[model samples]
Target chain A: MINQIRADMYRLTHSWGFYITLGLVVAYSFLITKSKSVGGIMVNGNQDALTRLSRENWTALDGIRGTTMSSSVLMYVLIGLFVIIIGYEFSQQTYKNTLISGISRFQFITAKYVMLLISILITIAAYFATVIAVSLILGRHVGTSWAHLMSTTGITTIAVAFFISIVFSIAILTLIVTNSVVISSILIVIFPLAVATIHIFADWNWLKYIDFFGVSNDVSLGKLTISQFGPYLLTCAIILVVCIGVSLLTIREKEL
Target chain B: MTETILDFNNVSKKFGRFQALDSVSFEIKRGDVYGLIGENGAGKTTIMKLITKLSPLRHGSISLFGETTGHYQQALKRTGAMIESPAAFGNLTVDQNLKVIAKQNGIQSKNAIDDAISFVGLEKKRKTKAKHLSLGQRQRLGLAFAILPHPDFLILDEPINGLDPSGIIEIRKLLYKLNHERQTTILISSHILSELYQVSTKFGFIHHGKFIKQLTKAELDKEKQSGIRLEVNDVAKAAEVLDNAKIKPFSVSNNHSIFVQTNQLDTGKLSQLLIMNGVELNGMTKQEGSLEQYYTTLLKQTDEGEK
Candidate 1:
């Protein structure tokens, strides 16, 4: 089990894709915070309005609403990252050899999840650190405090990013099922986009809380007591259970 | 008692209407280099999966190294397998990939990883990204990963499937070394019977999800001894008549040809016998059965089953 976990991490950690994703997340967070600067030169058109937007340059929870467009864009990027991450394993035919090493399917699935979680946590940490470091260097630390990093509220904000992890888990499940990346990625994109859009026009407010995005909203607000919270989490749980079950079944049935 | 390493008793698997493995049973003794050979879409892989317990056996039981499925961890702890194309992480370096498998097997000491790398002959290419490695190298890397735990039983399906001639020879040599030196009981499957014949001590012919026959090298050789070949008209009926006449042969070649060993039957009496049975013995020759002939016969039987 330990060896399999080690192998799982090794399988992922050495890639150009791994480094690139981590780098981009860190760079983007810096950009997001750097854009909040009031001094020196401004690049984008809405700088004046952006500076007024938030005085705190960067905090763990600050990216919750990240640049409106960024919210959707980041989601797209996260989905793509996950789909490719797990999808690449099957595409390259590596899973066939791995399973026969007497490593159980349960171990395979668990190790992958553990590795993906670690990678996501590492990347987001780097992202947030970049934001904080850049803020200090530019003297735009304004309303930010080191307390933000250690706060329960700050930690809870991580729950917002949990949806991306769920997407990744689903991506792995997709890999196990379809065993094809293009199809899995397409389904990932289509289902989310389709569901989110369909929710947009629904008359019932509760229906809006039926996607991963809704669960992220619940976590970001730091309130399970929030009205939209219950159904949102319920939906995420439902999806997770169904996906995990499907993944195990598929792996069991498919010939290695 | 020669220790039995792997035992599949009455195993069967079905996918809806299709049965991929039907009541397959076999056993591999310790120190046996067993070869499981079949055509494409045969149940060789299914057997491998069932041994690993990757796919649950629908109607039978599998035991590895004296331990049944529930206790297979012990059997598996010292086992290595490569059922299909090597499953590896493409982004990681070859060394890193081995390291991962080694670590999974609880070989965390850096020396163990380094040793495995050298074992697979990937030392110089240790840092090379996995995707950059050629097909043969990837296969070797997979081999290294599987054997890292120093298994007593190894199940390899198409271990040399896509390799060049040299790669195939190298792998055959490695398999021989493992079986002889390490005393590993290996069950390997390959489409090319000749490639496997050199190293295999035992052979199992699987067709359309059935292990129709299993024989040791001596048994197979004895079966081939005194073989005779025949070419005549009404091939099917002639073959049937010969079958009914109790003229057991090791193998039958294409186009009504049959191979019987040199001493199995008296040639004069055999030709006279078939002729007397209304089977035109157009061309009769004494012969020996090769591995290819055995494979072809089994494949023909499988084709007949499908029809």
Candidate 2:
């Protein structure tokens, strides 16, 4: 197991795609945090809109962690990054040679997931750092209670929300469903946009809660609750479980 | 003579309607250089995938080093291969590629990495990017990767597929050296039978994913279906002489020369009888079999299916 993990990480890490992704994200984080042009989002600043964003996340490092765990966190970089790591294996024809390396499909699949997980944690952490640094610099200049700006519950809520969101779950799903990177990336990205539209215009408000795009408004991260299955929350739960189930099933049976 | 390094029983793999391998069976003993040959779509790669557990067996069991399919890591880890392409990150150097593979297989020491590099004659190109290397160089790097862990059961599918002549020679030399020095049992395939013929001690001719025949060099050399050659004045008269003499299974080429099937025929007797029958007699001698001829014969037999 250790051997397989070592090999898988080596293969993924040595890839130019992996490093290029980290570099790009790091660059993005730096730019997003430092850029002075927040010509600003059209805010109805409706207590509801602020409530939604506020409930989704809280950060000590406003410039870094806040942006790090932003609802778009997974979508911005991880979608492309995960595809390069996992989806490329089957699409690029590299997996043909890799299979004969004397490793089983299960080990390979699990190792790949682990690598993605570690990548997510590390990159998000970097993004969080930028937020924190900016928050500190601005807090000193602007005179705000940076410490009281967030509750522990707020941070944990954001982490778990991102975890349960479509990024990791759908990335693994696409790994099994399509097996090809380019197709998977397009499908994964496009499905959410279409769903987001449905959630806005169609009667499928049920779907926002289902799995593709239901995010909580005021869930406490530090106060992690044993999820009470509401319709929206239930949809999220079912889809997340089903997607992971499908991923494992395909990995177990699908041809390498 | 040694332990069974690999075995397959009635393995069949199907890709939708097209069957890649059909009921293939073979056993490879330890330390043997086993050569596999077949035309395109003959299922050579499929069988290699089965043995290495790259792809699961569809209808049969494949055991490596005596372990069954379900728990193949130990057995598979003992095996190595360069199935299709020797692909790697375009930016990684040859040594880096070897090290990564070595580490992946649980080999931590740098000495093993260096040893693998030297084994493929790529020691000089260690610092060169694998993508920058020529096709032959990539082939060498692949060979180096396969052997880096010192695996006992090695499978190389068309390992020399894209090599220049010099590259082919170097790979062949490396294979020969491996078999001699490390006694690693190898199963390598090539559509060009001649390439496989060089280093393989035994040959298995496969067609449409079925095992046609397994022949040793000694058996091929001795039986001599391609045994004798003769120059005859009259091809028809020579045919009649051969018929009358009950010398069966000889081929008469367009040049009017006959290739007799066995060494037991008396060339002098054949010539005299043809001359007596008012046929011209020119010359006669023995023939050695080429790998291509043997392969064609085996494939033809499989095509005929004992009919």
Candidate 3:
């Protein structure tokens, strides 16, 4: 298992796509920091909007939230990265090489998952660093209490982790089912867009609670209450588990 | 008694509506260079895939080194294979690609990788990306991957598909060395019957997903039909003389040549008899059936049977 992971990591790190994707994520974060918007909603420099909100100060928590929220679109980049990494195994038939070398199917899948988790953690860290660097360069000030700052960062971290997990799981499941990088990436993009479109046209308020786009929006706006966050986290967790479970089952039965 | 290295027991496979393999059974004994010959879509690759567990076995069992394929990792640990085509990461250099495989198989020594590269004659191209390699070079890399870790059994499907004549000879020599020097059992498939003829100790002929026949080298050589040809001044007189001697000619050609099929016919006695019968013998040659002719005859027989 450790050998498999090492092999995957070597492949990933040696791939130029990994560095390119990381560069794009950092560039996107920098753009979001400069724009002062979370997905194009003006979160800074709008005194009336800030005063209307409960918190009037532009704190580091807001900076982190803005970066994470804007970088949600980086999910596409993440999916594309994994598509190149994992999809190439099937496309080039390298998976058969691994199998012939005595690596089990279960070990193959577990190694990929381990690599994905590591990539997610690296992406999160890159986003945080970009946000901190940009905020410091722009002389942005934090005026919130330390307790509040820590609590808000903790919640935002959890929300980002949940969202990233969902996207990662979806990427993995799509790659497994389709086995074509282009098709898997197309579906990954379409799934979120389809959900957002339905949420917009549907008149039901409950749609926002179950929609991933809605959840991201709520988290970005800092409007998520304990009640709303709990159910959203639970739903995302379930989707993640199901995607992983289905992938494992499908891969076991999959013909090379 | 030689131990069986690989045994397929009544294996059958289906892909949707097409049956790829039908009750195919064969065995490879230790240190034997087994050749699998078949036409396109003849289930050669399917059988290899089943042994490697690239495709799951649904209706039959495959045993490698006496262990069922259910314990494939343990069984495959002593096996190496290059199926269909050479599989390598296009983005990685040859050395890196080999390193990845070595790490996967838990070989920590760099010398092993170096030795494989040298053995395949790819030492100079080790730093080149796999995508940049010519087809023959990639094939060498695939062989390098298969031979690494010194497996007891090596399964190769068309291992020399894209090689030039010298490249083919190189691979043939390498496989021979591995089999004879290292006592490695090899199961190989190739369309080039002539090349297979040079190294294989046994042969298995498959047609339409069936194991039509399997024969040892000696059995095959014995089964092959041979004939004696005579170039004489007068074919008619030679035929008459052969008839008089109760030795019928199998064929009498327009070029004054007669062919006789009989292992017991002595050339010296025939020449003496022809000379005594006043028939001038210009030249006589004995022709042995080649592997190609043997394979064609086998296929023809199978086709006739189907008809």
Off by over 4 Å in 1: A37-72, A80-85, A148-153, A187-196, A207-239, B70-74, B114-124, B226-289, B294-307
TM-score of chain B of each: 0.80, 0.88, 0.86
Give the worst 10-residue stretch by lDDT in candidate 1 chain A. Answer: A37-46
Instruction: Give one digit per residue, the lDDT tens place, for model 3 in B1-307.
Output: 9899998999999999899999999999999999999999999999998999888899988999999867868889899999989989998999999998898888999999998998889989999999999999999999999998789999999999999999999999999889888899999999999899888999999998999999998999888767788899998999989999999646685667888876568899999999999999999888886788788879999999999
DockQ of 1: 0.42
Candidate 2 segments exceeding 4 Å error: A11-20, A30-74, A138-166, A210-241, B226-228, B231-233, B240-255, B261-286, B305-307
Question: lDDT (0-100) at residue B293 of candidate 2?
Answer: 81
Worst 10 residues of 3 chain B by lDDT: B248-257
Each candidate's interface RMSD (Å, one decimal) is: 2.5, 2.8, 1.2
Pick out the ten consecutive residues of candidate 1 chain B with the lowest summed lDDT: B221-230
- Selected candidate, larger lDDT, 2 vs 3: 3
- TM-score, candidate 2, is 0.84
Question: Best to worst by DockQ, what's the order?
Answer: 3, 2, 1
Query: What are the per-residue Cα lDDT tens digits for candidate 2 across B1-307?
Result: 5799888888889988998888888888887788988898888887876676556566988888889877776787778888777766556788777876776778878899888887778878999987799888888887887888888878898888788888789889988888889888999988767778788988887877678878776776554365778787778878877888788888887566988887776667766777788877677777667888877766776778756
Cα lDDT for residue B36, model 2? 86
Clashing pairs in 3: none
RMSD of each: 6.5, 4.5, 4.1
